[model samples]
Target: MNAPYIHGRRRTFSASAAVDTQNAVITSIKTDDGATWSDMGRVLGKSEDRAAAYANTASPIDLPTFLAGCHEWGGRFADPLLALVGGRWADAGAICTGDEAAALTIANLLPAIIAIEADNLTEPHELLPHEVLIRRVHALTAIWLEMIATEKGRAR
Candidate 1:
């Protein structure tokens, strides 16, 4: 296993992808103040797609869990401006609280990003829904800004 890196909220996150048939992709997160590591569970199997190809796989991450977490965090009320850009109201703050939230947001964006890539590869003229794209971008931006703020706070 590789060394874990600090993700946020003083948590260390790490993952090990399968290299052989006997291995499985594993992910775990540990809090700086805690002695025990919390397992985030397996991300992939050796028999499954290669770890390097994860980005190209459809539904590479857990979408339902991520979406549910976002909803649970009250993302719908986090940002009023989202209504203007995407014709929908959502609270971006709901998922910008910490490193885990940031990870979730990134995971949430992956499938769409992959789809965009697939579209580019297959049908360059395919038009994605502008509002959907706007909402995702807005959410990602909000999370990014929050992370920066958190990091700045740490600096002081």
Candidate 2:
């Protein structure tokens, strides 16, 4: 689901989803100017099999909450690619195989993330957008990838 958000602007967007438990039906809602949300009603019932397929395919990916939040915020900030890389790094760190280099790389990223958060608090929103955070995240991801590669090399 994707929507545009402009501060102090009147815009309308719709969100819809269909589910098949006992029946196939769609539920939808729309918000005008970020206010006065109203139901858009369900339409286009599909075959139960089709709905089931959709449900099966739509299962959420398992990820840590903090990493997921970072990805969501990255999308809102219009830098999903970078946020995704950061999320991958977080995932690698979580499942790290007790390698010293991987541990050190993950530790190094903590201060960078903290510094980015600190800078965000002081700068205007426009001045310190997600791009800046993404750059740091990308750097962290590179370090993480290098550490993983090094660990793999040592294994062989």
Candidate no. 1 TM-score: 0.24
Q: Estimate each model's TM-score.
A: 0.24, 0.20
Best by lDDT: 1
Off by over 4 Å in 2: 1-128
The positional error of residue 66 in candidate 2, measured at the CA in angstroms, is: 43
**In order, what lDDT does every prediction score?**
0.39, 0.37
For candidate 1, the 10 contiguous residues with the lowest summed lDDT are 21-30
Candidate 1: residue 31 lDDT (0-100): 29
Candidate 1 has an lDDT of 0.39
Q: How does candidate 2 fare on TM-score? A: 0.20
Model 2: per-residue Cα lDDT over 1-156, one tens digit each: 222233322433222221121111111111221211111111113333442333345432223422433343333222322323232233324674433454465565566557656745634453344555445456667768867976786799
* Residue pairs with backbone atoms closer than 3 Å in model 2 (clashes): none
| Model 2 error, position 43 (Å) | 75
Which residue pairs collide, candidate 1? 75-91, 76-91, 78-91, 79-91
lDDT per residue for candidate 1 within 1-156, as digits (tens), equals: 322244433422223221121121111111222212122222222223432333333324344433432353333321221222333334645543333454565676667567767735734344355445546557678757887977886799
